[model samples]
Target chain A: MLLAKIRGTLVSTQKVETLDGLTFFICEQLDIDGKPLGKYVVAADSVGAGVGEVVLYVTGSCGRYTDTTTNRPCDATIIAIVDMLDVDGKTVYNKTDDA
Target chain B: MLLAKIRGTLVSTQKVETLDGLTFFICEQLDIDGKPLGKYVVAADSVGAGVGEVVLYVTGSCGRYTDTTTNRPCDATIIAIVDMLDVDGKTVYNKTDDA
Candidate 1:
């Protein structure tokens, strides 16, 4: 699993039939310091996260193994909305208190 | 390599020195049909990609291999800005011509 932020949303009217009714979101990976880590990716939005929201993501087959994404042509997914983060014994993020 | 759409961006003020000055973006994986495939991820933005742009991303150790991301804790990165996509024989996206 990895920590990231929702960057944007993608809407495609034409695509594979198996991908119908699914929502996709772009995510920017956050380093331990919460800085933009110079990287980006497209992911399945399973957690209903919006742009600018911090999130947790999964990759590979684990990302494809979900109720909404099972057995599909997907490699990434937003699995959770992160409320806080504690890394190396420090409060990196506190959703309610920080914002 | 995989096909994705840039969703958003992330900015952090504190983090590992190695991760400084890097940009992270949110991404949603796209299926062959150009629909949201119900998956999302955080990727390091190697290219100057913006929201709503289609991009190519790499994963695993390959993602961490770059001038800005070498020897860091990362799993994904956007390697290129996708100008078009053709899967199983179809024009899903053509940047210059499509909106």
Candidate 2:
């Protein structure tokens, strides 16, 4: 799992039937320093996460472990809503800090 | 799926049983221009790709579609050994060019 911030949503009316009922989120990967790593992924949203929220996403076959991604073609999925980030015992990010 | 080049291998003695019999390859993601994208992933090799070979890898649930990755914890898997890469009708990468 990696840290990412939900950037936006992807809406597609025309897609494979297996992809139906899946919500996609455009996620910007974040480095340990909380900066964008200049990489982005469109991940299926397994959790009801909102835009701008920090999340943890799983990739590959493990992504299918979520109820929403089972047997789907999804390669990425937001699996968790992050509340805080701690690095080397130091708090780097805390959701409460956000107004 | 994404484009990547196998860089090295990873051996682990301690891991989940599902990961057993899985050969892990360290791969560097590539951009459309065939340049390294500064991202790396440890992918399970579904295809017989070797180090220095450019290959296509699948992630997420699709990564599990392969016989070797089914119901496993893998998130990335090399799905194809690329023979050529055509970008906008031009071959930017060809395995033959490596020789």
User: What's the count of clashing pairs in each model shown?
Assistant: 41, 3
- Clashes (candidate 2): 3
Which tens-of-lDDT digit does each residue in B1-99 have in candidate 2? Answer: 899887665544333445668776667789978898967666789888888889999876676789888876566789999988888999998889975
What is the TM-score of each predicted model, taking all chains together?
0.53, 0.54
Error of 2 at B42 (Å): 0.9
For each candidate in turn, give its C-alpha RMSD to the true structure in angstroms. 14.8, 9.5
State the DockQ, from 0 to 1, for candidate 2.
Answer: 0.10
lDDT of 1 by residue, B54-76 (tens): 77676776566555566776678
lDDT of 1: 0.70
lDDT value, residue A27 of candidate 1: 72
lDDT of each: 0.70, 0.76
Tell me the spans in candidate 2 whose CA falls farther than 4 Å from its real position.
A1-99
